[model samples]
Target: MDDEILIVDDEHETACHVREGWKVLIVDDEPEVHRITKMTLAQFIFDARPIEFLHAYTGDEAIAIMANESDIALILLDVVMETDNAGLNVVKHVRDVLQNPHVRIVLRTGQPGQAPEDDVVANYDINDYKDKTELTSQKLRTLIRASLRSYRDIRTLEHHRRGLEKVIAASKGIFEKQALKQFAEGTLEQLSALLALEESSLYTLRHNAYELRNSTLETLLSNTVLLVGDDKANPSDVVLEAMRQRQNLYRDNELVIFCNNPRHSLIFHIEGTRPLSQMDTYLLNLFTENIIIALENIRLNELLADNQREIIYRIGEIVETRSKESGLHVKRVALYCELFAKLLGLSDEKAELLKRASPLHDIGKIGIPDAVLHKPGKLDADEWEIMKTHAQIGYDMLSGSDIELFQVASQIALNHHEKWDGSGYPQGLRERNIPLEGRITALVDVFDALGSDRCYKRAWPLDKILTLIREEKGRHFDPDLVDLMLANLEHFLAIRDTYRDEFQGE
Candidate 1:
């Protein structure tokens, strides 16, 4: 079965990029200073990008603009404004208060005495200090270029820092997911985040593990490998070549990453606007290493769950065999419990738990004396009392285990015989007092048991069995469960037909 990519967002999100142009904020009280600075950089285009100018007359205004805009690349500030030390204070706001270490601040003052150049430079975190007299067009352009270049380098470092953080966080998150598909989808999503991807990029999984049908991801998180770039170029040949070679392949706008293990072979097809840079490659590799390990962990969990299911059924069969009942009884009961649980609107997780635990409802019968257990006739009052002790015995045997499966089994074991009206059971837990797991198991077990041949009695006709169940509603059985069972009788019958017991007589 293909898994749906419900945890995955269909939209492709790109990494952060530089805005329209490098932002240059001019913080000076003199209107002429702003004009001259703008004129000085009117023909300026650094690294083939233009400057976007922002002006603030007062230190307060500079702080306000800085507070609103986190991506202002450079600030050309004046030392004195509303307050004599306003520009210095703006530097404080940008550094200590805003904690914005990336934006480059160059202090330019008309009266350097208000805040001396050497003193201000040493005490404050300004990149450069320029007196008003040093206003040559060439010098100013060179200054602007130097500041913007520094800003770009810092932004790159910040981007990488954020990227690494995402990888670390994503690794932790994927490990916590027990389901294979969820983990895979999460991996694909994280992969998409590593590059500036196109909206056309698709994520799919190999080995049919994840099937992302532009809609659902089958395996590998989805059977979808994200193919990025111009949609016209088919990377099928490249993908096949990588698979054969068992090596990672990178083309102009495509990436074929091959990961092979003894259990499975997965090829990740990633596409982007341009060829992957060394940094992008490094991040993806790191992400892949974490994902492969998480995949192994999920596989182990799956194997363990399979083994547990086998052990439970085998144990239940052993107990049933002692009472001369067919093993199919446990299977039917498990399926019925799952069905009933689902119909009751229990989640998939809860429904699955009930199914796995219901088989052991009669596990306590293992401790019962064989003479009463396998008897060909009904037991007398004393013998019946001895037979009834199996419920508590089963609960006691399973309750001590720390495992969740057994914990639930203990509940089912203890309360499966409890009647709705407190008329039956070891503890006579009445009505809703019985755990829902116990109640669901009780209804389904009796329903299957009555329809099947027991050692002491022949299988009753369907009509008789259902009549007894309907009559006992609100008494022996939960009225609501009984109603649901009757309503979905055909589905129940289908389940019975699917797991047929050969001992069921004509």
Candidate 2:
């Protein structure tokens, strides 16, 4: 980056040969000073570009103009404007109070007696001090070029610092959606301040036409984006228009929002009063695109969570159908698993996953023959052996899935039938070797199975089932899980009784 050119010589002809290539602010009390400065630089265009001149007759007026326009690359301040030290005051205000460090300040005094070069240099933050009498045409152009070079350097450093902060904020927000709104607001605020724009940019987030949100208010602390005013116009609608038009209105311009949707868009104006620059447009487009990607990621995460729950519910139904029990059997098993997991002090996430996976404990029955699955009489050794394969079948059915619920479901299917005493099925795995989810589901499955009447069996009394589970502790079930279930026996029974399907018979 190069510095913005500024010519501070009070002499008009001395500033000639400088043209269109840079943004300059010429501050002189005399009107002739302004005219001579413009005429001399008129024929000499810098890089074939036109010059932008800001004129101020007094230091106070210059300060006010600079307040509104911080993009002034260079200031051609005259030491004597309204007061003997008027130019010096402007420099103090720019550097000390307003802190416009990016704008290069050059102190040019017509009468050196008013402000000495030594005092100005030591006491003030002016980048350069020059006496109007000493400045030649060559020196004037050289001063402008040097000042612009410095200005460009400072602006680049400032931009890099702000960009790093934005990336950090954005990364934090990516993992925590709650933090995203604030991050977005901070990014917008930094960009606005850096660019020295007039209007504070606004952000609106919309989902389909039903919900319109503003990023500032809703996103930071609430669920949606915070809108500035209520105009009843859909934000998403505006975004669609901008997208359809393929214009920079949504991409690079200020006063125009780059909208990804009607409900969500960033509304901001360019830093200066000037129209948006090509660079400004390009940067804003990049910003909007990044935000859109973040929003999409949030939406996708929510969808995946919902899908996980739905899959669990479907698997529960499949398990219940095979056992000749009402479908509610699956629901009861899930509730019991949740309660037991909580009793065991598992985290909410783990508990929920267990609840969803618990019902698939017998999912291997999906592979069992109806003769064995709905047998009216006790199975012979051959039939019994075939029945046990249901556990392995359940494990096989659910294995190799990337989804969390299915992964746990696979473990439960493989281990749920294994007895605590190492006397049960395919692997004969015992004790803590059984997955916690499998242990938790095993007890709940039995409780529901025993409490409910199957095609070939009658429903046992709650008291009887409770006694049976207590007696089998450490023999058929993991004792710790059994204790947890026992403590919540009534809660389990209530769920069992509630989900019992209405059985119709001939």
Candidate 3:
């Protein structure tokens, strides 16, 4: 398996990542067995590296070792140590309890009568079984090599699966325009890691090659990075030359990759001391191809998200306006939700999603009659009941959409009204049953709502608002979140101040 590495391109680092010795665990009770096994394999090497040895004397000890050691390639086990079927139980623990199916287990027994070879092989998921007497030096060596090869292949596939999963998780949010620069930076770091290369950069310039109509290209042309030596730069020359020749460049210690979409072209210049191998070249080609596609997707998705955001604000404003509220209330609420998410340590993608989706939290309020919504006095019991239905109404309007934003928005609209305690309306879900996004919106929305002017109630003073929040901890608000709000109260207040309603000063 290629060790999880960034696409870096230096010989020394590449060698270092893959050169570590394979780990082997020796499990037996006898001191001589451990001594002889180590001596036998003292000079043995595979794939240009020696073996790392670990010893465990009992089934309990082996199980302990297996618990802590994830990368052990092989276990040479003795069947009748401590108990008659101790090795069998160790195998069960390794395979069943630990759920580690990758390590190769070889069962060696001193007494053939204690564990019949056929029975041991059939019952246990062991790769090999042999009577201790039958293992000559050559035979033992052969078994070790075969087992190690199988372990290597299995681990390689497992590592690749994990690598792909991690890539997907990280890149799933890459289409967000704000993430384009971040994605490029990560790719450069990963590329450096994958090839063991050093620090590098990716720059994108768009142009119609034949005409060179864009005026900005002139300044960009001068300061472009050079691949080798004195660091003058060539984001322009390399791209233009490669475009002119219509091929990627392959010179000694330098590589110029040229890729283009119909609208524009992308070129990269990298300097490496090691010459490119066919595998290295292939990986680079695949990476660049995917990166070009990602850059294009970000462009398209950014446009779509911007439009969605505008519609959301407009929708939120229409609802608020009918209730005699400022449109900037929605804006303030959005910013507050984002700030709360940030303080909670939500990922940038999740926090950004929350910011975008939060404006629609009250979209269901659009369905409420204006008389109840805009009433200048406290709501009657019947009117309060009617007002409470907006949560479910908003959810109904937004739920069942395949779009990710709408799905998140739907949950927020539905659950934000549900309080930290069971006293909340609609479904009466209490505590953590409420989704985190809902909890976040509920807190920030209340913070904004209490601090802002409403036709029914004047905006409360800062001290009064905080007093209520502090009193509501574990009642109306999540205790931890309330604590977080208190801890970063200044920043939250700053966000509110920044996006405060225009009428607030009056």
Point out the higher-scoring one by TM-score: 1 or 2: 1
lDDT tens string, model 2, 276-363?
A: 5444455555555655666566556546666766776676677677676667778888888888878778877788778877767878
Give the residue spans of candidate 1 off by over 4 A: 1-19, 81-83, 185-282, 453-459, 504-506
Estimate, for each residue in 124-213, the C-alpha lDDT of model 3 and write its tens digit: 999999777776666677788899989978866765554454445434444333464465455444444444321122232221112122
Better of 2 and 3 by TM-score: 3
Looking at model 3, which ten-residue stretch has the lowest summed lDDT?
A: 4-13
Total backbone collisions for each predicted model: 30, 29, 25
Please provide TM-scores, in order, for all candidate models, with all chains considered together. 0.81, 0.50, 0.54
Model 3, clash count? 25
- Sort order, lDDT high to low: 1, 3, 2
When summed lDDT is taken over every stretch of 10 residues in candidate 1, the lowest stretch is 1-10
lDDT of 1: 0.78
In terms of TM-score, the best-performing candidate is 1
